[model samples]
Each structure stands twice: as C-alpha cells, then as structure tokens.
Target chain A: MSAVIEIEGLRKTFRSVRHGKRVAVDGFDLLVEAGQIHGFLGPNGSGKTTTLRALLGLVRADGGRMTVLGEPSPELLPRVAGRVGAIVESPQFFGNFTGRRTLRLLARAGGVSISRVDEALELVGLRDRGDDRVKGYSLGMKQRLAVASALLKDPRLLILDEPANGLDPAGIREMRDLMRSLAAAGVTVLVSSHILGEIQLICDHVTIISRGRRVAAGRVDEVLAGHDRHEFLVRVAEPERAVDLLHEAELTAAVEGTALVVSGVTDPTVISRVLGEQGLWVGELTPLRPDLESVFLELTGAGEHPSVPRQVDDSALPAGADDAAVIDLDVRGVDA
Target chain B: MNLVRAELERLSARRFVQLMVVLLALAFAVTAATTLAGSHRPSEAELSSARTQAAEALQGMEATHQQCLARQNSMTPPGETDDFYATDCSEFDPIRQDRLPIAADYLPGVFSFEQQARPLLYFLIAFLVLFGFLVGASYIGADLNSGGVVNLLLWRPRRLTVLGTKLGTLLGTVLALAVGASLVYLATFWVIGQTAGLGGRPGDDFWRSLGAIHGRGLVLVLLATALGFAIATLGRHTSAALGAAAAYTVVWELGARLVLEIVDARRPDRLMLSSHIAAWLNGKVRFWDNQLCTSSSGTDPCSGFYSLTWGPSLVVLLVITGGLTVAAFAVFRRRDLL
Candidate 1:
C-alpha cells in the first residue's frame, strides 16, 4: 500500500504574548499507509492536533516536508483535500439544522451526492434520529453526526481528532467497527485518542508522541513488546512468601501485589518444578506477555486503567509476575 | 438551483438578517401609511376652515386699505401685477397656485410600498444597503476568531479563493437586498404621492426628477454598501464595523452640518450619510464631513471640497472599495485562521 500521508522534520511554533514563544509541534515525522488504521496518540497540547491541522493546511508549518496522498500539503491541499475528511476538535453543526440536513449540507460542500448523506447517517447509526435538530441531540449524537458528515464524501483518508469523544461503550465499539470497515475498504484512518486501551484494541499501528515529538511508533505488537523481554505474573497462595522464596533462589523477581512477576525465565515449567521441589505449593503460574496497555504506560507513564498503578509509585509492590511468555503452562500449580 | 439560490441559502444561515428584514418591512409600511394619511391635502371641510382664515385676513386688510385711501393713494406707483386680487363671497372656494416642487421633488416615486413613507430611503440605506457588509464582517470574523472557520480553511486550503468567494457572495447579497428594498420603498412612496397630491399634469422635468431620485438612490446604495463592506472586513466583526459606519454616516453628518452652520463655509464635502445621499441624487458630488471616512479634506479637516466631479467621485469610490478588498484578502491569505 502507498503511504497516504508522509511527514518529515515538521516544525510549528506560535508567537505568544504571555509565553513569548511556544513550539506546538517540532520535528514530527509520520507515515500512514493506505488501508491501515494508524493511531496518532498524544497528550493534550502535545501538537497532535496541530500536526493534523497542518496536514489539512489550516496552519502553515514553520519547517517541514509534509505530503498528503503524495501531494505537498500546502500546494496541493485543495486537490487532495476533497478525498480526505476531518473533524479537528469539537464537532460544529448549525444548531437549528437537523442531523440529516447538516450531513446533506456537508455533502454539498464536499461535492458528494445527496444519497451519501443518508449512507453516512446509517453508517453512524444515526439514521433513526437523523431528522432531529442538532440542538436537541446529545453530545454523543453530535459526534456521530460529525463522523457521518465526514464519511459522506467517501474520502480516501479520514483524519479524526477524538472521534469517540462522547461515545458510550456501545457507540465506541460501533465506531471501532466502522473504522475497521473503512480501512478494509482501503481508506486510510488516522485517529487521535487519549484512551490507550481503545487504541490497542482498535488500531493496527500506533505512534506515541510526547511534548510535540515522536518517541515510539510501529505495529501494535512490535511497539508493545519492548526491548525483547517476556514477563509473566505468577499467582500463588502465599504471594509475599512466594516472592521472598524466589529471591532466596537467586532469581530476580518483581512483586505486584499478590502476583509474583518473574521475568527473564525461559520456561514456566522450571519455576513450577523448582517451587514444587522446594515444598512450596504453587496455585497458578501464568505468563504475562506484553500488550499495548502495559507498553503504553511503560513508554509514556500514562495508562487508561486506574487500578494499574505506576510501578514507580509502588516500587515495594511486586511487578505482575514476571514469568517469561510461554505458549502453555502445562505445570498448573495446585488448587487454592 | 442557481448561484442566487445559493446566495439566499447562505444568507438564510444568518438569523439576524431575517430579523432585520422583517423589522424594516413593517416599519417602512407603517411610516409610509402614516405620512400619506397625515400630511395629505385637506378635505372640503378643512378647505372651509382655511377659507375662513383667508377671509378674516382680507377683512383686516380692507379696513387698513380704507384708512390708507383716506391718507394717500400710494398703491398707484406699485406694479399692477403686485396688486392683490380682491374678492368676496360666503361659500368655500378653491384657491390654487402654480405647483410647488418641494414635496414631489423628494417623494419616492411609483413604488407602491414607498408611497408617503419616504423613510424607506433612510431605513433601507441604514440596514439593507450598509448593514449587509457589517453582517458579512461578523460572518467571517466570528468564524476566524472561533474554531469553525479554521476547520474549513484547513480543509479547502486556498486562502485567496476563500476570501474571494466570501467577498463575492457578500457583495452580491448586499446589492440584491438593497435593490429589492429600494424597489419596495419606491413603489410604496409613489403610490402614496399619487394618491395624496402629485395632481398636476406631467411636466417637462417630471421624468428628470424621477431619474434623479432613482439614479441617486441606486448609486448611493451601491457606494454605501461597498464602503460598509470594506469597513467591516477591516474591522473584522459585525458590531465594530456597523457601529463605526453608523457613527460616521449619521452622527458625523449631523455634526458636520452643525459645524458648517457656524463656520459659514459651504460644506459640499462634509455631507453625512443622508445629506450626502441627497446631494449625490441632485447630481452633485460631496465629501463626508470628517476624516473618519475614506476621503480626506486636505489642509482643513473641516473644510473639504464641496462638490466632486461626477467622474472622479465614481472612480474614487470604486477604487477605495476595490483597494480595501484586495488588502483584506491579502491579510486573509496568510494570517492563521485560528
């Protein structure tokens, strides 16, 4: 697939009265392949939105090589823009207009057929209430209408900033499915979201940004599996004593609550046998492979789940059992 | 289906414009009706009252004439044409003279809605002609200041085209609205004039009078609209531009007239909106009173040229609007919408 979006050495700064000068985006580079769901993840004000705006030609960059669908962003913005759709931040719709009418207006502006308006509404699951005035609609409904408007043109590339901002669980899932379907139809989808778990589940590729610069980017698995380490969390009856026993065995282990996480081991069977021989009854030993959630926190020190506290804050607590990743744990520990 | 429809649709997007149209229409209708009904020539009963006064004046003069005759026959030297026609009767009689042009001269003609309600001239000029530009300013300025315009600018990506389209649409709407409003006002005024007075036979200059008012109103509307549009674009908001235009047009004109009254200078240039429009309709070019407007009166801010060559006035007006438009677009092209 061709790279639908390509950026190199992008830099953007704002002349501010209060702050003197603020660089919103700096040296940001990214390539989004056609037909792939590329995740643009960043904290608020990290310049993710700024980069998107630059791509749309809303803001001129200070210095950068950027192209959309292989066309230079500035010179070819008009030609390439019709084939791309976006919702920069908050969804804007005429308050008096109906959801259906707003989409129809957008379709007209985008030079698409009127039928596309209905298609967009149906795709966003807003068809039943399409005639409702936007003012009466909920925030989630407004967001859906925005997506519907963006999809009306059947764009080849879709840039959405927090597309799922007001969506409920079902709505988010539906949006994920719709995005996947769009990607399957060969449309490049670049979405920015703060929800890491959702990104892990929905995106095919992820790019993590920090303070207006990229720090990590790659396929979901390639990025999540950091530095070639496989770790597993070992659950047993005596969590503290079990961890101490592993420490006595001359093996380095991290304890996260009741789970004794052992890393660097080649096999879980060895840990099970060693514990069994030592007169220690093991309840369960499960391998914890890297996922997007843990990797995201490890990289940015931020994660969606609140229960998963930072390891930095609770160093005394064991890291989830660091048992090395194994296909199967045939040596199941004794029943509790 | 056509561009006009699109223009109307775009205008429909704005709520204030709709309100303005409704208010102007009702106010114009009522004012026209009031003027036509109130100022119309008297009926036979009222004519009797006028006759009674004329008779009373004649009686007093007769008593004085008896005494003068007893004293001196001095009326002989006075021209015979100056002699008052002395008559006497008890019934009402029609007293007529050659028609005065003042009322019909300023009357809005042939337009049914503008009949008697000449206020349409000021009303339309105030809202329809000039306010459209002010409205356009807010449309673009609000969008630019807020986030919505930035979103569209990013997507469409051509600054010049965006600016040009906005300008063209705004100009088109202003002209169309001004013309439509003028037509309504003219029609009403003409109807009222025909019914109330205008009873004289069509004179040689009748067509000229009509042409003068029509031509002047149209030209003034066009110029005023362009001027206001440019100002709004410059101001970048609805209120500031509208307020400035209003102050310059209304307050400045009145103030200039007051100043000219004291200074003993003929202020051909210092015409505020209504007076300037009146002068222009008379085929004379006058400058606005203050430096606030586009044209400046050299040396003396108060002493501007009274009359402009018609050709130069037209050219200057166009150039000012065109130049300001170009400048506005240049700023629009590069400046960040956000």
Candidate 2:
C-alpha cells in the first residue's frame, strides 16, 4: 500500500523570548498507508501537532523530508490541498458569522458547491444549530463544526488534530464512527489525540512517539504484543498456595486482589499444571494481553516497565527495536 | 474574483458597517434640513427696508455723480466727446441690481448648487475618508482578532493572494460607498435647494466641477483606506493601527509643531499629517488669519495660502501607502500563524 503521509528526519526548533530555544520535533519519522485510520500519538508537547502543522505548511521545519499524497509538502501543498481537509490545533471561525455562513464562505473560497454546506452541516449533526452565530456555540459544537469543515471537500486525506477534544462520550463515539466510515470508503485519515483507548479502538495503524521521536509503530495488536514477557490470570481457590506453587516451579506469580497473575510464561497450560500439582483446583485461567495504553506508557517511559528496560536515549539502536522481538508479553498487571 | 465578491458581501453585511452607513445618511439628511432652514429668505419688512435704503443711497450717489459729470462736461470742448463722463443714468437703478430680493449668493438655493454644496461636499469627503479608514482597518483586524485567518489561510493557502484580494476588495467597497454616499448627498441637497427659492438649472460646467470634486473625494477615501489597511495588516490588529494613528496625531505631530515653534522660523505645522491630507485633496493649505500670514499682504510671499503641487503631493501619498503596504506584505508572508 502506498503511504499517504511520509516524514523522515523532521526537525523543528522554536525560539521565543520567554521560552528561549526549544526543539519541538527532532529526528521524527512517520509513514501512514493509504486507506487506513492512522493514529499519531505522543505525550503533551511531544511534537505531534507540530509535525502536523509542518506537514500542512503552517509552520516551517528546520530540516525535514516530508510528503503528503505522494507529493513533497508545502511547495506542493496547494496542488494537493484541495483533496486534503485538515483542522490544526483549534477550530477558529468568524464569531459574528453563522455556522452556515462560515461554511458558505469556505465553499466560495474553495470553489466547492454551496449546496454542500447543508450536507456538511448534516454530516456533523449541526444542521439544527447551523443558523446560529458561532460565538454562541459551545466548545463541543465548535469541535463538531471543525469536523464538518474537514469533511466539506470529501477529501481523500483528512488530518485532524485532537478531533475529539471537548466532546462528550457520545460525541466522541460519533466522531470515531465517522472516521471509521470515512476510512471504510477508502479515505486516509491521520488523527492525533491523547486518548489512547480511543485511538486503539478507532485506528487500525498507530505510530507512537515520545520526546519528538518515533518509539513504536505498526498494527495495534502487534504493538501491544511486542512486550518482553507473556502473562496469564490463574484463578484458584487458594491464591496464596497458587503463588507459592508457581514460585517453586520458578514461575513468577503474584496475587492481584483475588487472582494470581502469572508472568514470564506464554502458555496457560504451564500455569494450570503448576497449580494442579499442589491440589489447588483452578477455577479459571484467562490469558492477559497488553493494552495500547500500557504499551504507550512503557514506550514513552512515563509508566513502569519492570520487564523491559526502555532505552529511548540510545542512539545506536532504533527505538522500540528490543520490543519488536517478542510476539507475546506478560501484561497481567495492566488493567483492562 | 469570487473571493473579492465574498469579501464585499462580508464587509457590507457587517453590523458596524451597516450602522456607519445609517449614521452617515442621517448626518446628510440633518445637514440638508438645517441648511435649508437657515437659508430662509429675508423677511418682507427687512427686504423693504433694505430696498428703500439702497434706493435713497443710490439717488444721493447719482445726484452727486451727475453734478460732477455736468461740471466736467461743461469744462470740455463742445465738439470733443467726453468719453469718461457718465452718458446714461439707467445703470443706477438699485431695484434692478438687487434682482433676487434676497442674498442668494450666500444661501443654499436652486441656483446656489455650487455655493452651498461646497461646504457639504467638504464635510462628506472628510467623513467618508475617516470612516473608510475605520472600515478598512476593521476588515482585516477582526479576522486576526477572532482567529478566522487560520481557517481562511487553510482554505486559500496563498498568503499574498489572500492579502491582495482583501485589499482590493476593501478599496473597491470604500470607493463605491464614497461615490454612492456623495451622490445621495448631492440629490438630497438639490431637492432641499429647490424648495428654498432655488429655480434655475445649473449648467454642465457646474455638474462637471461637482463630479471632479467627488472624484477627488474618492481619491482621498482610497488613500485613507489604504493607510488603514496597511497599518492594520502590519500590526495584525485594528487597535494597533488606531493607537498608532492617535500617537501620530496627538504626540508626534503636535510635539513636533511645538518644538519647531521654539527652534525654527518656518511654520512646521504645515508638515503635519492633517495638513498633508488636506493639502493632498485641496492642492493647497490655507493659512487662515494666522500670525505667520496675517502680517503679509497680497497673494505672493508669506501669502495666506500655501499651494501644494499636486504631482509631488500625490507621489508622497502613494509612496507612504506603498511603503507601508509592502512592509505589511513582507511580514505577513513570512510570519507563522500561531
């Protein structure tokens, strides 16, 4: 599959009087395949939004090779801009203008049909309030309007920065569904958000970054399974005896509330066998898998990773290279 | 072109713009009504008193001139024609000289289109110029203030194109409003002039001069709008432009004039922005009863009028506008929208 967005060695530095010199993006590389909902994840101020702005030519990067829709960006942004709809940072509109009027202005400027204003409004579920002035709109409504604007051109590539910001659960769900539907219809979407669970559920592919560098990226399941150790929830009547029995067999096990969390073992049969040898009847055995949130925290070094020693600062090896070796890893300690 | 059309629609539809237009129209109507009321003809008793006094004074003057002429004629040879002596008494009729029964020359009447409309024209021109600047400044200022430029730039992507289109659209709208408002005032004044004993139809020359005056007013309006657009774009806000204008007029210009008064012999107030703006339009600045010019006589050196060469003033105006506009464009093209 062709990449919709590609970036290599992207670097951006900002100099301000109050903040002095700060590197917002350093050695960032990203690739998003066509027809996939790609998640661009990062900690706050980790350069996710900066990269998107640079891709859209809103901010000039110091050094980078970037492309969108197979074309090098900025110089060719205008050529491909008509087929790309984006909302960077926050949605801003003329306060005095009604939502419908704002859309009409965009339609006129973009040479799109005015009739699409109503359609775009309907798509975002804002048709009822489209006639109201934007200044009176709530923050969630503003976010929905931003989504509607991104969908106005029926763009093949949609770049949205925090598209679910200020949205309630229902609104976030609607946005997720809209993205899924758009991707289903062969549109490529690059969405950045801090909501890891939502990204995991909505995005087929994810590229995780920390300190302005890509730490891990691939299919969501693959990334989650890349942990160094496997884990299994072995539920038994005597949880303490189950832990001691696993210790005797050289298996790491700990009581997590009511269940014994067995780590460093991929096969659940070993856990069952270890417990059954001591006459400890196994009530249930459930395989524990790592969630995207835990994987993100571990890669970012913001959360505890007892099994894997993260070396994000090591320049010799590629980031996340150590985790790529494992097909399954222990994640029983991670919450569902 | 469609962008220009959209901008025009947006400018015209703005509430402030609508309010300004309504206020301008009300001002015009009030000026017309007040001017018409003040132009009421002299009372019948006052006219009669003035005519009787004028007739008596004329009879006295004629009796004296006739006696002097007769004495001169008698002193000359009978065969020689005294060409300097008054040969006819028919020209001394005061009633015939005072044909309109009122001082129609100073009042706004049908025949006084050129006389009375001159002040109204000046007032309209000044008001339009000031308001044009305001409208032009707010046009881009509101966008920057409200963060609308983010979406606008995303939609268009060409910064220079967006700026150029907006400036063109603003200039076009200001010029149209200036011309349209001028015509409305002219029509209103004409209707009011007819009701005030104004009966004669002005000739083509008067209409031509009126058109030329309005044409110059249009130029002034364009200059003000350009200045406002340049300043607002350069600062990225209307308040900046307004603050700068206030400083220039109140501090820079006034302070410089005061300093020049203490250190220089020349009248430096003539170099103020207000003076230059008036000079650009009027082609001269009138030094009305000032200490600098009241001591001098005639229309020569130190005269009551300082004529500004139209070509040089026009060049100065364009250079200022173009310089600010270029500076604004350069910054706008490079600066990142954050």
Candidate 1 per-residue lDDT over residues A1-336, each given as its tens digit: 789999998887776454445656667789898888999986555577778878787677899899998899877878887788788777566677788876765555445788888888999999899999888988899899888877877899998889998899999999999999998998899999977778888899988765556768888878876644656678777777776777777666777876788878777777777677777777777777777656655555455456875332221101332222111110111110
Off by over 4 Å in 1: A227-229, A237-241, A301-336, B1-7, B39-120, B145-155, B201-320
Root-mean-square deviation of candidate 2: 10.0
The stretch of ten residues in a row with the least summed lDDT in candidate 1 chain B is: B86-95
- Tell me which residue pairs clash in candidate 2: A229-A329, A229-A330, A230-A329, A230-A330, A231-A330, B110-B198
lDDT of 2 by residue, A43-118 (tens): 6666777788788877778898999898898778888888899998777777788999888888888888899899
The best candidate by DockQ is 2
Native contacts retained by model 2, as a fraction? 0.38
lDDT of candidate 2 at residue B20, scale 0 to 100: 84
lDDT of 1 by residue, B1-338 (tens): 22234334545676666776677778777877776766564455655555566666556655555654533344434322223432111111222222322333343322232222334455555555445655665666555544545544534567776566666676777677767777777666666656774444445465456555556566665665556555655655556566886687566666766676677554535333444444555556545443343353333223333464445555555676678777777666665444
Query: TM-scores for chain A, candidates in order?
Result: 0.86, 0.89
iRMS value of model 1?
13.1
